[model samples]
Target chain A: MEELTSIHNQHVKDWKKLSTKKFRKQTGYYLLDGWHLVNEAVHAGVAIHQLIGTADQLDEHRELFDDAKAVYAVTPEIMKHITDTVTPQGIAAVVDLPDAHRVPTQPLTGAWLFLDRVQDPGNVGTMVRTADAAGFTGVVVGHRSADLFGPKVVRSMQGSQFHLQLFEGDLTKWIADFKENGAPVYGTQLNPQAKNFRDVHPGKTFALIMGNEGQGMSQELLTATSDNLYIPMRGEAESLNVAISAGILMFQLNQ
Target chain B: MEELTSIHNQHVKDWKKLSTKKFRKQTGYYLLDGWHLVNEAVHAGVAIHQLIGTADQLDEHRELFDDAKAVYAVTPEIMKHITDTVTPQGIAAVVDLPDAHRVPTQPLTGAWLFLDRVQDPGNVGTMVRTADAAGFTGVVVGHRSADLFGPKVVRSMQGSQFHLQLFEGDLTKWIADFKENGAPVYGTQLNPQAKNFRDVHPGKTFALIMGNEGQGMSQELLTATSDNLYIPMRGEAESLNVAISAGILMFQLNQ
Candidate 1:
């Protein structure tokens, strides 16, 4: 394997560029840094374009190299240049982005999570992880939401991405697709007419829409839903954290 | 306001030492960094010993900080040295540790959250924030748990700590006290015999015990509880993130 030593090296420069949304969009790939995330990516059968690490780091994960298309050795400085973590873990990989093809309009089962403009990567990642744990079929990342494949989201999800299918497109179209199949759509709101989350039935296929950290679901999206549900809070605190509220609502809907 | 320009400044050195647990214990104060967190400490009545920042930084928040006990002007370099964030918000405060006596022995009303060995500061802080929103009377931190006043915990909790009473003590003793008050204790566990969280009748007065991130509640603690509840999951994931799980269970119980 060839070694990458300099910060200005072509490979290092290319890897650094992957951090931008435009680069990721053009290349259809994203970088996964740190040993844990790289290992999880490999375990999930994610196709790797390349694996780069220091000699010592590579020695530790030789088993991961068995199926890699290409492997290269790189120095600590080079790893830091390509990675976003405060302390680079001496290992990184470029994995193919999963195709976000729309699922069939029919035969959908279980609940789904719809995220609308939730910009925080950590919150987006936690919601995906929670959705997967609650048996949601897929996560639909709506307009202005954080990139599902971003480094921060990847770390926060803790490998739940592999278990769930992620869609990045029109939430309205997706909702219409599900509605045609008889799936109940629930939008979270603070309205008096909204039913309590627990009071709703969980036996049927459904989708729960979670909005941005500040502003919630858009009026157009909220009106599109079959029912509006609110999680009752007894305290004077204004609202629960978006991720925590989503988790609570998801679990309640599942149960 | 005194300007601290050098790393060797006695006060700067002392504040930097707070990175170590020993120094924090010795000084009877912990560091709170970032504008958001410093504001939270002030709002929580956590007793800010010193508000340290650059002139420009302090200027931005001057109106919100008229009552700060002591304000110290520092250079950017000095501010960076005393903070953990990559980009210091130019403000960090030293807050006196809350006396354990202040934590209410008896909750005025509603449920309480008992956290045991929750090592992740982020999870611990998120739990506190959630508890505040869920209308939990107070939060009890048990053995091996993250420090309630730690920087990371304080940041994640936002400003919820100010509104809720916090206790750090033996779990066994707290459980006994709850029992003496006739408040039912609900412990989260995976036992098949445990009732589903949604199925349990949420009484006005109860304490919900959330355990470590990796391990659920201890066997002894589980045995002491009046009821064991499990958040039902239908997917292949091992368990929900500890903080997310706590939020789910707490919301359900409060409802």
Candidate 2:
């Protein structure tokens, strides 16, 4: 019920720190902006540490107060300082990071997406969203890839993060684990040895590895995979966008 | 090459004006940032009105000066002022807009993408990038769609703007024109009446219509199409990202 007006307020400083990876790691929480994302977080039963909003936003979403732990009325300027978006949506929430390390005990039992150094946050987010829509088990963000919890990634994922298990770490070790459990690791490549993605069938379990935006897959990662697949491009384009390529591959593999 | 330090300098003022659509139109030029984008524009033979960079950046890419008309050395602060990107890449360019209207004079002879009210700049840019990779004839940005030359769009497209024709106008008129010229208009939808995208051939000449991010398509536009198609999704996602959906449909229709 307290109001935060000044830019130098301690609470405002802590909220702004969420934008940095170090602070997020230390606090185990990140800021979610906009009513839509906040609503999704609430629906997913995400623990809300605090709900901060401008007077107008608080008036509009007064119903949310019934379940919120704490609510504070903040000025538009203060709201903008805490949010990552260029234009603050007047509402923001601090939500706990879901325990991402808990992968399902069962092996990936459907299509799965493995990303290798896919640096663009938006692309990474779109791939996650598409993988969820295509019924994939989960998305594994590789060593050099963008942080899965980055604000842009969260926004682009459109709440799919709740539906999917996201893990970050050594992709090679994870691939070895997947192989040991009988899941085929399908790495996408431009070489002639690659099969058309459409030729693959959606089965009980499999992993599709999408590489970097420009560099493709690392040689070691590509060699370790069981199959190399490609989405046949009839056009003059050098390659498809990584996210789009992932979406098409997911659809074809699922079909 | 002249150095421009004052924010009120005539050229600096003009370059800053590019952030607005009206100025870009009046000048018949647009701003592009980052080394990758500038490299793309250079390779595409786009006329560079000015190349502004910090001393370090200019020193690194000195060879690029072989073709540049004018190169200006400025402080990093000045570079940031003329660029839309947060980290500016220490470089930005004002380049001529290609004559997109003239490039599509012939009837659309391959998969074409028609965007209807897709307001997200990133989505529009990604769609154009996908269209380029899929070898579509061109992309028609509807009246309500985001401007193709916007900074975020240019970044998301990843140089695809140079490879494809971008037309902006009324969707109904363009759809009717394509239909009359023997190109079937295929509108993507979720209705049962719509055929699965994989099942549709689209022959050799057709246009695929992707609707708004929130609302799929206008009823009038949907009714005007020659055929309706949907990308079959097996998962719990309500819908695919518009750009990803466009990619799926474009690739399928091309196939």
Candidate 3:
């Protein structure tokens, strides 16, 4: 309906701000890149406030703009500046952060995953995606971690965010609530004192806490966990990749 | 130690060629970037043909070159040219590929993991690392997949290749050998007809085949598998990251 050609345009500047975590958090909105992710967000009823793309991308993904969303077309140079990617997928959406900031589900019947300062965006997204596949009840993003609404995190989740409950809370408080709710909360540590993951026969309602890539779970949360589980490494690698370990633990414990 | 300041020096030219897959394959050598990986290769008794680093990195890790065939100091400018990374870690090595081409251990008494055209270098490396953590016997790198010794993959593997038996072979032949040796082989696909991974109570000796990022396992290998396994998804995500699924399968199948 409208065209923006200059990189200095006010709207373009505002969209570019979404690239930063502070701006996204402040505005309660973030951008989704590529057609597949935006399509999933649309199908999941995410509150998409605006769609911007080149005419060709619009023609191909035309169905995505069907509802109450402002639409804009941008010249190729403006598109390049807005997205900041060399090969822009040529489409993006300005959407509200999903309603993931909840207290752990009140009943706490399904499994929950808590990430403690998991800094890498891809790792954060992969952990969330796997938690969904393992049928975990929800994911609680710990404070000081990669922003869940960041573009890289969104891409790595591959739209799994739309399918599951996501929460951000002080993990200390979440662990306390889960313990009070009768869901045995577990944290991972690499030590002889920790029980092997294979030994865990957790109930349907439980919580698993995965922590920072280099630093394991926070000391305060580890102390609160009912049991600290270790995934044994027979190899010389000091540790497993954080997301891979999360997947193994979630599926094994959920079963 | 000798010093190499010119990026166009004859030896520097040859070393830089290791950055490409075809050149590395042709020369039977590849580059390892960063101190952690180069250190691991040194300790693992991997054939490191040459070591290159700044004076400080070399002095700190001098023990690494005690028995090295050759060692050299390079200018920061030249170091930048060779690795092409913004932060080069001030270290790298030209190392021979490990002897990962052996036939599947003929008796095939332990678990085997196969990668069938999994293209993402990080995914391929993570798969190998987790397989080692799960105590699998060996990993077979199938054709058309990421080069296991490529810089990105070598970094992601975190030196797990040294801890496990790695073989590059046609997966079809490996699957046949696995079956012929009385080990049940499993292939992953996302279909209702396939058995859910949780339903599998597999024995200690087995072979698990993971497929390409987009395409599942090739039909040739799929038909050879004793069972096609599916990691059931409880949420809306279409499938798990290849490395994450491999981690789940390896640990669950091992148990």
Candidate 4:
């Protein structure tokens, strides 16, 4: 492992760019922080471009060296310089973007999720993680939603992206595609006339659309959905958190 | 109404202490930020102890002053000093903690949620909001859980706390009480032998226990439930986020 200590080092400056969405998109890579996420990336066989860590961290987790393209031991200050969080974890990795696009898994034969402009990075990541947990085929991150590769979204995804497929596209297009293919496409909203979520039974193929945290799915997309359902608010809360709503729907609708 | 300019003012100093659990408990108060939450608190009838805001904030939100105990217009710097976030919303309130104790809404009726040591402030708050939305009787935060009065938790609860009942105590005791009363208490975990949550139809009344983010419910508490249910994961992620799991169970079990 190469040891680097200067905060102004070119490598350090380049790595820091991973924290921004623009840089991530330009470079086709993102930063993975913390041991668990990095380990998950390693397990999922993500191409690790660089593994940067403090001396102690590298010393304890020597096995990480076996899978990465390169490993570097850096001073704490240098490590901190390359990360955005107030407290930087000791180890992180720069990973090449994997092939994230997925659709018609087995040609329209599995559950999928479409997030419509869910602006919050945390919510976007949670929906992806939940979709992965529910055995969904993939998640379509709608245009205008939080950047799927943004640092916050990456952290919240908890490396689940490596486990399943993720795609960025227009939610309405995905809804249309599913509907055209004869698969059920359910758009979640607060429509009073929509059927209750409990009454819906999903078969093997479906696309569940969860809308924005504030302004829900675009009006056009909702109208295009094969059906719509609302989770009844039995209590006084105005609505369930968006990510939670997505999870409940994914699990309940998963046959 | 009083206008205060200095962050060093005693009143300002006292209000700043609200971010901590100890100070919040000792003063029987906590800070509420953003217009939506403060407005929700007002609508829910929670007694407002002090309203603090920048002059413009006060001007724009005059209605918040109508019933508050006292109102003060402070500098933007003072608003920043009194809040936890780097960018303060410019308006906030010091509110007396409302009575949060609850057991049976009508004695032996209504679904109740018990959170067993769920430590994330966001998770704690989301469960409260979900409990309110699901129309659960109330929520019981067990020992070792996140502070109910913490700022993050309060923000996430979003005034739902005022709409429904919330109590803090031991999970074991609450489980015993609900079981003794004959309302089926369902503890959610990933135990393979546990019945699926979907199979258990929550009637007019029952108790649903959600475990902590990392540990799930304590062993003793799980054993004391009327039954245990699992949200079967059809996908590969190890587990669902705690708040998402709580929301799913709350809606599934809410008759």
Candidate 5:
């Protein structure tokens, strides 16, 4: 076991850098701030590069240390500085970022959720968790979407990331691949010509694409989809929150 | 227009206090932090006690002044101090809080959503917005739920607060009132005996109750409803986000 006390320590400084996307991308690692996520990572067989915690926390969860490639006991002040939390949880982990670009070796089946530039970390994470609950196959985070490995999304996903496949790819290619595999690709829009979502009975093998916060699906993707679908709004609200729309569609279609 | 350049101005100090729930309760007033919300409040016919903004912002939206009882032009520094945004929107309003305790004066004829101790301000507000989009008649923020007028919730609502009625009340009383009016009240729970939400066919005049994020609905409320309903989770995820569940149930039941 290694020990670190000062926030200025080289190892502490490196851990603090994981908060930024650039650092995580460069290092192929990201920080998990609390015990629940660290435990989930251990159960999921995620490659945890380092386990860092206060001496008491490390002793309490000593079993978790065996799963880490390295372990460090740090002062509470150092933990707070590294985790960037006002009230530090006293336990953290440096986990390997799964290969987001890895090609799918298995056949594509079951429902899939695709993000088309959905920018909010909370929305991105909520949709992923909803997809998992809807029993969807996976989520494909398309171009300009929030990074799944970012801290905010990681917090919002609530461990669902371990339950399903998450991919990063050009949505254009993913749409083509779904169609090539005979899966109907559905795009959401508010245009008059778009079919009501209730009318579309999607099967197990299909894809649902949600768009950005202020904008609907891109024109190109909308035109490429098998059919654009809309959720009928009976009230005066101009639109549904994207995450809410995604949840309604996934549960309704999956059923 | 009266102008104040100093962040320490008496009016600025008073406006800043609106951010605290205790101060808001004491004065029966709350703050709206941006132009869009101020515009929505104006259109909704909500009572605007005062409007505060930077000089340029006040000039640009002079028409909004007619609706406000008082208006003040302040420096950007004072505006930031009042609104508390990292980059202030240059505008804000002191709005009268609606009487959350007022009893209904008209017949209840459409679907109503109830929040039972749902604590997350964002979740509470998102559910309100979703209820609005789903054509719900109103939402009852049950005891212990997030304050509807809180800043985080106000922001999440995105003007949907103007689209539907919002109330704060005891869940048991609301459920009883719904029943007395010959409307079925549905409670959400995960118990095995709880009917699948898909199995219930709800009419226009009914109520759907969601529960706390951690604990489900209070046992008393669960037992008092006409029948408790559960969304069937097809995936391994333990549960759906409360807001997502509310969205799914609202749309499904309304249809």
Candidate 6:
């Protein structure tokens, strides 16, 4: 039980760097800021590289020490210095980035969600959680979408990241793979000419593509989808929030 | 054409106060940030108390001046001082708060969404936008929900606030009113005993209630509804984001 009271500690400095995507890429690990996420990672068998917390938090959650390879007790000020949140939750974990390329050997199955440059971390995270609730098997976060392990996205995902397979890759290739395998890939747009989502009935294996906050699905991916779908808006609202639209489509298609 | 050069100007000082809920209530006005929201407010025929902008913004949107009762040109620094966003869009507005109690004399006809103690500003705004997209005619925001006009909520709303009637009131009373009028009021929760939302077929006039983010619904409201409804979860995620749940429920109920 090593006690590190200085925010200048090398380990603390390294954990603080996890806040940036480039740093997380340089080192295959990300920081989980609160007890809820840390607990979820441990329960899901994620490899905990290290666990750092205040003396009181470490004592209260002493059982979690068994799962971590290293544990350090620091003052609240040091804990705050290591996490990005305005008020640190007093405990954090450094977990190895799960392998995104680990798609099962079996044929692609179940509902899959593809993000096409969805930029907002909150929107990206909410859609992932909704995909999990809707029974989607995995999410292929397209290039230009918010980094999956960014602090904001991780906080919003609320531990659903561990429940579903998440990958970052080219959306065009993912759509092609789904279509070639005979699974329907539905692209969403506001165009009236597109088929209404309710009219398109999908089977157990399908993919839904959500686009960017403003520009929407790239022209390439739009052309790549099997058929484009649109949710019927009966009111004067110009469009639904990207995350909202994704939830509606996921629930409807998964049925 | 009055040009104000100082952040200390009385008008600038007054506009800055609008960022707080107390001042908004005291003055019956709130600030609309950016060109998008200001333009929407003008087009929607909302009463614009005053329009404040930097020199370039005033010139570019000169046509909007006719709709605003008073327009003031200010230095970029003053514009920044008046707005809450990190980068002031060079334009902002003071809009008289629309009367929330102005429910139509006619019976409530279209679907109405009710938010109970949903505290996240982003969640509140997204749900409002979704309600509009789903053709929900109005939203009754109950006590403890985020202030509808808060900066984060207003930003996330993206002008959908102008598309729907938003009310702030007691959830119990709103639920009772709908029930008394013979329209089924559905409450949402995660308990297994609650009826599945898919099984409940709502007509054009029913009301749906969404509760707090952490706590699903107040016990009182859960007991008061015609029936409590739950969206069936097929995966291991504990629950849906409040806004996502609201979106799924609103779209499903409207359909």
Give me the candidate number with maximum lDDT. Answer: 5
- Candidate that would win on TM-score: 6
Better of 3 and 4 by lDDT: 3
When sorted by DockQ, best at the front, the candidate numbers are 5, 6, 4, 3, 2, 1
The parts of candidate 3 lying over 4 Å away from their true place are A99-107, B99-105
lDDT of 4 by residue, A1-255 (tens): 788888787889889877887787788888888888898988888888899999999999888888889998998888777877678879999988654454435456688888888999999999998888888878888888998877788888887888777888867777777878899999888876888998989788888888889888889998899898888887677888899889878878885
Model 2 lDDT tens row, A1-255: 778889898899998888887788888988888887898888888877899999999999888887678898999889877785788889988988765566656655666788999999989988998998888878888887988887888888888887777888678987898899887889999765588777777476888899998899999999899888987766556677888899888887877
Q: Predictions ranked by TM-score, top down?
A: 6, 5, 3, 4, 2, 1
* lDDT (tens digit, per residue) of candidate 3 on B55-94: 8889897787875789989988788888877888899888
Worst lDDT 10-window in candidate 4 chain B: B98-107
Could you give candidate 2's per-residue lDDT for residues B154-218 as a string of tens digits? 88788888877788878898888888998799998976568878777768888899999888999
* For candidate 1, the TM-score of chain A alone relative to the native chain A: 0.94
Q: Which has the better TM-score: candidate 4, or candidate 5?
A: 5
TM-score of 3: 0.94
The sequence of per-residue lDDT tens digits that candidate 1 reaches over residues B1-255 is: 787778898999998898776788788887888877777666666777788989998887786466567888998888888886778889888887666545565444568899989999999998988998888888999988998877688778877777888888998988988888888899998655788887888678889999988888899999999888987777655578888999988877787
Interface RMSD of every predicted model, in angstroms: 1.3, 1.6, 1.2, 1.0, 0.8, 0.9
Residue-level lDDT tens digits of model 6 in A1-255: 789988888988898889999899889899898989998998899988899999989988889989999999989988878786789889999998876656544688999999999999989988898999999999999888899999899998989999998998878878878888999999989998999999989889999999999999999989988999999998778898898899899998997
Instruction: Find the candidate with the highest DockQ and give its number.
Output: 5
Instruction: Give the distance in Å from residue A77's predicted Cα in candidate 6 to where it truly belongs.
Output: 1.3
Tens digit per residue, CA lDDT, model 1, A155-252: 77777788877888888988887789888889998664788887888565888999988888899999899888887766656677889989988887
Tell me the tens digit of each residue's lDDT in model 5 across A68-138.
Answer: 89999999999988877788789999988888899976579999999999999999999998999999989
Off by over 4 Å in 5: none
Per residue, candidate 3 scores C-alpha lDDT tens digits across A126-221 of 998898888887899989899897878888888888888888878898888889988799999988679998898978888999999998888988
* lDDT of every model, 2 decimals: 0.83, 0.84, 0.85, 0.84, 0.89, 0.88
Off by over 4 Å in 2: A1-13, A47-49, A53-63, A86-91, A190-193, B1-12, B31-80, B85-95, B101-103, B190-193
RMSD of 2: 3.5
